[model samples]
Target: MKLPNTAHTSRPWRIHEIAHDFLLEDVWALPTPGGPDDFPRLVRQMTSGSNTNDSRAYTALFEIRWRLGKLFGWDRPDAGIVARVPSLRDRLPADLLAGPRGPVFSSVPFTSVYQTDDEWVAEMANRTVHALMHMSWVADEGGGYHGQMAVLVKPNGWFGRGYMAAIKPIRYLVVYPALLRMIGRTWELQAAG
Candidate 1:
């Protein structure tokens, strides 16, 4: 479910230190509820492209985005991580820097940054923005845990800001709801299995 930005801002996440200047574009409460030790499972399920089926709308939207990016040179390597923007990993402390960089993403264009016991960070950059995707395992009062996700982005300039504004509605309306359903189904299946 979509969450208030404060849901992320209130937490003392390591990402805050790495991407302090980025806007909190989104915060979401994932449906993957489990025990404290289950964070690795959640992260694995997420990075493994085969774990869940994507919504057709999302797939189509992604395809469209890619096409647009290609036509506009938005996804050139020179426009990515170290070329157009500094990598967030450059800001990591020694501990985080030496820790697991998480799994290789099977489908997305994101690069794994670092991972701790309860948190994982991945990043992607293009002409429109330098962005980070952060996931955390949050404990509930009942002693169980669930996942949370936050997206942080430093838009490149006026064009980037407009790009973000253009996509906001589709992201909130179609993309996120589809992801929520997909994750919920996968979590339920994991429990049943």
Candidate 2:
């Protein structure tokens, strides 16, 4: 991985820097496989539109894998979707649930820590798994930091705003309300305990 000169002064936003800073030394020991074969297909299904299974899988492979490339110190984020480690399911930080919403945080640095093209993809897959399983069971949608660049499918002038409006109902009504319920349950469970 190429170290950024800027990284010397402050945290760099480049994917390589993010990976090196956050994921270094930790990723190699992760349980994920070395390449594409290890990625989770279930994640693709949750995020993709009505594209063919292969196409959806392929797209997930490319985007998530690209993100993973930075984690390993590769120059380009790369392309292609791939599997992640099962250990990714190990646990989310309890702090991830502490935010006002549901712990949806992101940063350029987070993308870089994936260690390989597939690791990023796997992390995304893990996010989707959380979204699917707990989309309605938490307070914030990962603390309202639902990841970045994932929503910019066609970020044209009006396209972005229009897309936001189209999904506004779902975002505010369905997802948010469901998230409240999820968070409520957690509190309730803790209270019961």
Candidate 3:
């Protein structure tokens, strides 16, 4: 479900230290409830590609986005991370740099920034923006844990700002609801698998 931006900003996340300049674009409560130790399972399911793989609607949106990007050169390799903008990896502190940086994603263009038992972060960039997808395991008062996701972005310029504005309604109305349902269904299926 969509959450107030404060749901992420209120947390003492390590990401705050690295992505301080990025805007908190969206926060959502993921329905993947489980034990504290089950975070790895969540990570596994995500990296396995089940979320987008299983949902035709969700996949269609991405396909459309990619096709548009190709038409407009929005996703040109040089327009992405390590080229257009500096990587967040460059900002990592010594301890974070030394730790596991998480799994490489084969399903998407994002690169891992860090992974802990409770949190995982991946970053990506295109001509329009540099973005981060941060997943965190949050403890409920009753001892169960659920996943939370926050998106951070730094828009490239006037075009970037306009692009974000144009996509905001579509993102919130169509993309996110489809994504939430897809994630919930996949979370349950992973438990069965």
Candidate numbers, best lDDT first, in rank order? 1, 3, 2
- Measured by lDDT, the strongest candidate is 1
**Tens digits of per-residue lDDT for model 2, 42-150:** 1232233222222343445446645754664333322211333222223333432232221222321122112221223223322112111211111122332111111
Candidate 3: residue 106 Cα off by (Å):
2.0
Pick by lDDT: 2 or 3, better one: 3
Please give the RMSD to the true structure for each candidate, in Å: 1.3, 17.7, 1.4
What TM-score does candidate 3 reach?
0.95
Structural similarity to truth (TM-score) of each candidate? 0.95, 0.23, 0.95
Candidate 1 residue-wise lDDT, 83-147, digit = tens: 99888989999989988999999988999999999999999999999998899999876788999
Model 3: number of backbone collisions: 0
Question: Model 3 over residues 157-187: C-alpha lDDT tens digits?
Answer: 9999999999998898778888888888989
> How close to the true structure is residue 121 of candidate 2, measured as C-alpha lDDT?
22
Clash pairs of candidate 3?
A: none
Worst 10-residue lDDT window for candidate 2 reads 130-139
